[model samples]
Target: MEISRSLAISSWIAMAIVLSIAPAGCFYLPGVAPADFQKKDPLMVKVNKLTSIKTQLPYSYYSLPYCKPTTIIDSAENLGEVLRGDRIENSPYVFEMREPEMCHIVCKITLNEKEVKDLKEKIEDEYRVNMILDNLPLVVPIKRLDQESSTFYQHGFYVGAKDQYSESKDAKYFINNHLSFLVKYHKDVEMDLARIVGFEVKPFSVKHDYEGEWMEGRTRLTTCDPHAKQTVLSSDSPQEVEDKKDIIFTYDIEFQESDVKWASRWDTYLLMNDDQIHWFSIVNSVMIVLFLSGMVAMIMLRTLYRDISKYNQLETQEEAQEETGWKLVHGDVFRPPANSDLLCVYVGTGVQFFGMLLVTMVFAVLGFLSPSNRGGLMTAMLLLWVFMGIFAGYSSSRLYKMFKGSEWKKITLRTAFVFPATVFVIFFVLNALIWRQKSSGAVPFTTMFALVLLWFCISVPLVFVGSYIGFKKPALEDPVKTNKIPRQIPEQAWYMNPIFSILIGGILPFGAVFIELFFILTSIWLNQFYYIFGFLFLVFIILIVTCAEITIVLCYFQLCSEDYLWWWRSYMTSGSSALYLFLYATFYFFTKLEITKPVSGILYFGYMFIASYAFFVLTGTIGFYACFWFTRLIYSSVKID
Candidate 1:
């Protein structure tokens, strides 16, 4: 029995190893054939029109191969190296026409025959010519005739650098030889070619820092090109060349005819879009929203109306009867909830998040946050969040005042600090870990400083100003007067219990968004593109409606149960969806991700906690205010004597 168990465990381990590495070798399988395996289609280079421009940020592997400052004075004359959320539509590089054809290779050497021969004798390193087009890396192919392996391509060459991962030295060479890269046509792949649409070199910032400048150029390549320099320029001054500050880059492009259409290049972005599953999610969400809306409408039009009419008529008769149901708790309903100060703080943060989401969606819908621009969406969100601090201050202060809480200063301070402070601390810790790893994705210290500046100089001040304005305004008046003593709560049904109700109430909101959540996770973790903001915006609206309607319905039920402690419960009921989001993230990590490192797992959960908390704030706020308004409207309509 022990031997059999050991064998079974060994087999499982072996299978896990194979599965982990399977994706890397999948392309080499016999079933995976070349593009032109059955039919011959001549390769062509097709140039695409430049859709957007972006600043190039240089990255190095594990902080190896240190970059040097460029001495090219004329380069980067008009370009800004550091990107402070600037659009590059006003770039110096000009692209007139885009077409695909065979490209002609041009090589001009100013070296004498003896010098060239001597240089060739000393050349020991394989020089790789790499191009950046649309911020995408293009590399020269090193051919291998192995039939068992898929065609592997390399983009960069080693220069006296050992393998950081293995700690093993591959090759060593002296940098004493003259180097030149020749443009060559790639004939291995059919129907796929590169056309040099345009090329421009300028001094740009490396790693989002202005401390070091890199003289890098991007050559726009399309899958089609026949060699002709219709508009090409190269700065080949002898002085600049002697300084070794300038590099002359030439490109040869070829195109291959393929069954794949160019229009469908972005088809991957359609993740769940335009599919039956997508429509099903949409239909499911709509049904829930409609059901809740109908419930709310019925209560407002029928039950509440009858209750209010009966209560008013009771007052006109000599034998006046007492009220029951939601009206019985009217006195304590307007009474400030326990810990109103904390609730006010949360309300403020929720308002801020609400504004941030609205502005971000607007910008995304307007195409200002296109995925092609890289980091544009995040940049926009951060900026909008900073500016929307005033909303947080205003909303929190007003709510605190409505609650008759005199600690306006404390409310405003916590509103500004509590959640945002937690987020920033977590971000800093994560960033520190990334920096320790020396990963290129690590946010630089300077960038962190800038963020701090934006927060304090802009967001914080705005919050204060908003708080002042909100405090100066009159406090919100409640429809019913508060009794000196609180009303005794009655026993409730199991369904009306806070824990049970919150658990049940959270499910619908989670259901409304789980499908979309999957696609969003794919985009984030799988590196897939997500550009269908139209559908996203629609889903956002659906989520809002779902939260509001569900919260209102749930609040009504709770009030009907004579539980006036709906302040925190209302918020938690809707915000509980974020708990499910965290659960989904855990499931996704175990099933979808092959992350084997302990550090990665920890980081994943850490960041996920921050995300879940923020989501809780956003959704919880929505439910609270929705219920608040509903309570106010219903109570105000009734005549109390």
Candidate 2:
């Protein structure tokens, strides 16, 4: 026990030292370096090469307006890219709509005999198709030309994938209709670039007056003509273009700029609310913390002090009579919970979760996990979780030993497999559903297999090693020895009822995080950006402190009521926050989300369930350990013969 304590202390000190120095040597802090910020001078668009029906590449064909495909320029990978940043390519097509010569293009398609023969040979052995729609990935990196320094592109949109492309049975209909773009010009003239915000495969049938006649002859692509002066499309002034074989597909252009500045582009959504919600959340959390802290202080400084002093001076019968509340239950306070092994496992897993979060946050604060590097956050989180499995094994084994558990091997195995397996199974089921829907987001079979390998080869082995070390150490010595038979728990007051207490305890923690929760939910569901990790990290610390104080305070009351079964109750008390979280997610969905599709709803809830379950584990573990230490500290303070 002494050796274990020493090792634990040493490890923490070492980690603290490393965390303090590592950030300085590694990445520069956000907003600290002015030279790193540079504007992207000219926005570029690249077209990906052509793909086939056999290949699943999203956009494979290169698109050139008037210039050749070889004119597209690829960009270099830079460090200052935004989260989910794209590699920009110089666009072959450029327009100066303010000129007297309005650009017009009438494209004609001609089949290359040699290339057609090669395509036939490639698809000949497989189930064949005469013609496939050649999709294009127009990579448009949006850089605010106004801002000279901030170059990170936070958002971009793709054009394709509608019923026009998918449902168009004929090849000619698909080509003529699907190749389209929506042009939006602002009324203000300062905005140099017109917003080609979206592309679509609109039915060519919408353009022609003949309802049933399939236009098969020729297609036209054009811009605003110098003579026509066509600019904006409305109900009164609709699009009127020549539909002959060599006619132009007219695109009207105008430019308008708004009040949105480039400096706040990344956080435009957050700027909308003006930090009012964030302040409210912080204030709410502070109030809860103050209330919990006061309650705990009273219990520690006043109530526990009086009881301990009185117990020490128990010389008369009256003095002994006063030792009737929490002091009376000290003998059974350290008693192992029912299903001691499972409880230990939970505690261990919770420790792992805590460690993972701490390390990940530290890295994030150091700027190692930035939006400039795509998937860095998730990748870091996943790796940390896996490597932190040792904590789960060590914590669970130590607690189980303290509980006088003998089945160490069985406990460790279950500790490694149980919770993770449940999560993996749910994930796999959800992935299968996604695969059935043919969603691009589905995890491939190889990736799933790789994940399984990572779990077995890395996480499970770490758990085993940690369990071995933990089990070798002596069990923690309890201040008050357990009695042969368990103490009978007395009935409690209405507020002290487990269900009521658990429900109430959860509300404060949930309230502390609900406002931030809204922003997080918006990022996930509404496709908004979340870059406020510093604030999030602050909230996370507050949450941990709140859970601990609340659980410790409640655990004191429960013990005073002669309810010695605090092992699970302490866990459930704070863990119940997950229930509130899940409920809030449901509320957010119904109130904030306009998801009409049943599949979308199912996907949202299914993932949410997994997330909530993990949260429950993390919070519960924290509460239990806090109360455990609190119980020990108070009991150990009083002299017991």
Best candidate according to lDDT? 2
lDDT of model 1 at position 141: 35
Best TM-score among the predictions, by candidate number = 2
Q: What lDDT tens digits, residue by residue, belong to model 1 across residues 574-601?
A: 9999999999999988888766546556
Per-prediction RMSD in angstroms? 17.4, 10.3
Model 2, 316-404: lDDT tens digits are: 77666667888888788887778888888888888888988887787777666644333456655665677777788888999888888
| Clash pairs for candidate 2 | 49-60, 49-61, 50-60, 50-61, 83-371, 221-249, 222-249
In candidate 1, stretches whose alpha carbon ends up further than 4 angstroms from where it belongs are 1-132, 135-252, 255-276, 316-321
lDDT of 2 at 387: 72
lDDT of each: 0.59, 0.60
lDDT of 2: 0.60
